[model samples]
Target: MNRTKILYSAAAFIAFSFLAGVTLQHATAEFVPEWVKNTAKWYGEGKTSEVEFVNAIKYLIENNIIVLELDQKKTESKTSPTFENIIIPNGNSKVGNVGFYIPLNLEIEKGTTVVWINDDNIEHTVQSQDEKGNLISLFNSDLLRTGERFAHKFNDDGAYHYFCTIHPWRVGVVTVS
Candidate 1:
């Protein structure tokens, strides 16, 4: 083949490969992946701030669309006690649909420490209460920001109801047995 034709073919192949890679990178979840890609693009174009870019990535990771690898040795703590974790997902502010705490109902054994992790961009509170709206002093997290965590040990056997003060509609229950 002619040198010019060969060069053109090579360029086309490179362009196709680049486009394919980009397409695959943003092909996971329907709306979230696209939103993440656009957020990154906007950040690169200076249309968005660094905070927004980082938050978008966090959202993606929290939603399981993206998985990050961390040094397990550094993250592991020998003194840390293992607890049952519940995630306060993003979009919990919404009235219906996917806006609520994951595993609305949880059951754990007595002496188990229940940990609530805030995976949303907005702040949330893990306030323990009863069915009649009476507050429980056993455990109450005032305000948890994104990536923050709150934990409480269930020493007794009973049903503990909790809710987010910011969005009372987002409620959950933990039964200790």
Candidate 2:
């Protein structure tokens, strides 16, 4: 090839490599909370839970809200960790009980596992499905034994609607992005 053509081709290659590196660096610049970092690593290692797993996203975000308040702590980065929680209480109006009618709003990324704990002295099952009341996966234990727990992992990317089959009065929704 001619000397000028060769030099032009080499310059083009160098420019492409530089641009690729810049793009990759920008992608990883997103900030992921340490809790989520640990959770992802642990989940990848096959750990499971029915309570804290889903709440990790919420925990990290809530704590970060305080950190980001400081000018030095905030970053121009845009990546965020998603977490949430929902507690289902037993039916039969025991009145004055906490977690009853308490709706938890959460935003979680895809592949997060949500754990549901039955703190009531009754049995409850965590079932997921569409809005039409279809059957999804059923995770439950006998009366939850008043401190029993149930957990499920969500790998898909979308919203998952869930409810308690045993108690039709119980209903909840989870959105996985």
Candidate 3:
């Protein structure tokens, strides 16, 4: 091609490469922002609860420090009401209850199915129970290993409490309305 065309092509290639590099960096960088590192450090030091650490991440998302983009059309097409899934993290030896669920309390509409994902290496069970510690018998998950998930659908309106059988201290509540 002509000298002018060659220069234009080279410039376009450089610009595209720069843009691609920036996008890759932003995409591959740890999802956690710098602001969350301090809270995570505190959690590691046993100064913060799992709920509080998750709330810190939520705060970052709310403030736009972390942006989450979802396909609205695809998500809305689902028959059942889709809710944000909860995560059960692994316990840290230094922190007593770091293995607890991220959200201690969750509120959802009736008929919504809540999924609890086991992100921890240890096994966990999600057993629904009454306030007096009696099993509800409606939903009891099997021993969940790492990367396993348990889902429960709440058809009626009430508050349901659940705990991990192995770790009684790891408790969570779900309110259906």
Point to the candidate with the largest lDDT: 1
Preferred candidate (lDDT higher): 2 or 3:
3
Q: Write the per-residue lDDT of candidate 3 for residues 130-176, one digit (tens) a residue.
A: 89887778799999998999998788998889988887777788888
True lDDT of residue 9, candidate 3: 31
Give the range of the ten consecutive residues with the poorest summed lDDT in model 3.
20-29
RMSD of each: 20.1, 20.6, 23.4
TM-score of each: 0.52, 0.43, 0.52
lDDT-wise, the better of 1 and 3 is 1
Model 2 whole-model lDDT (C-alpha atoms): 0.51
Q: State each candidate's clash count.
A: 0, 4, 0
Candidate 3 structure lDDT: 0.68
**Residue 124, candidate 2: how far off, in angstroms?**
0.7
The candidate that wins on TM-score is 1
- Among residues 3 or more apart in sequence or in different chains, the pairs in candidate 2 whose N, CA or C atoms overlap within 3 Å are 50-115, 57-82, 57-83, 58-83
Clashes of 3: 0
At residue 161, candidate 3 shows an lDDT of 93
